[model samples]
Target: MSTRTPLDVFLSDQALAEAREQAKIPGTLAIAITPAAPGTQCSWCDCDIALNETEHRCKGCPNPAAVIMHQFRHGSPVRVDVPLCTGCHPDAARFVLALAQAGGTR
Candidate 1:
């Protein structure tokens, strides 16, 4: 029996839930980071990052709040690293690199 835990998910920074879920890969996450100091919930698994835990983020795309407060105001896309826990960061980064190597954005 496979029991899934909260730590076993990964979400992308796509602007919409549909886009986020298009990957539809098992063992991934899709929750928004909210209600914490600068968004505390992990972007991938939505797990609360303990004070002692390490966190990481990937290159971010424009989201509404960020567009209004940052990229738009800055006249360019701002650096937006969606908060992710250490556990999820490596796989997400590897996937991104793989995509870049593919030479065509899907």
Candidate 2:
């Protein structure tokens, strides 16, 4: 069993909300963000290239040109967001568009 303290057990919702809000404010606290290792590959096509903020290619063909979020609903709603390379992004977009038009989800 885990030991619990009164301070931990009695955390208020407002306190939690305030803490979350503070975390979003830049320079509220000092924190270091580590960059990805050199030779990091694009998430979509596994191309060994420098990636931008979204972990996709920064340049060249087959690079990620777009990031898309797809919402799926079967019984419960689900969301999927991914970066796609230029070659695959168009096809994926078309498929998602078609699915939305058909009012279907999987």
Best by lDDT: 2
Model 2 lDDT at residue 84: 53
Residues 1-106, model 2: lDDT tens digits: 1343555445433343444454454323211111222333224443455545475543433443333323323333233434454466566567656765675543
Report the C-alpha lDDT of model 1 over 11-31, residue by residue, as the tens digit: 222333443443254332322
Model 1 weakest 10-residue run by lDDT: 64-73
Highest TM-score among the candidates is held by which one? 2
Error of 2 at 88 (Å): 0.9
Q: Please give the distance, in angstroms, between residue 51's alpha carbon in candidate 2 and its true position after superposition.
A: 34
Each prediction's whole-model lDDT (CA): 0.35, 0.40
Kindly give the stretch of ten consecutive residues in candidate 2 with the minimal lDDT sum. 29-38
Off by over 4 Å in 2: 1-77
Please give the lDDT score at residue 26 for candidate 2. 37
Q: Using Cα atoms with residue i matched to residue i, what is each candidate's TM-score against the true structure?
A: 0.30, 0.31
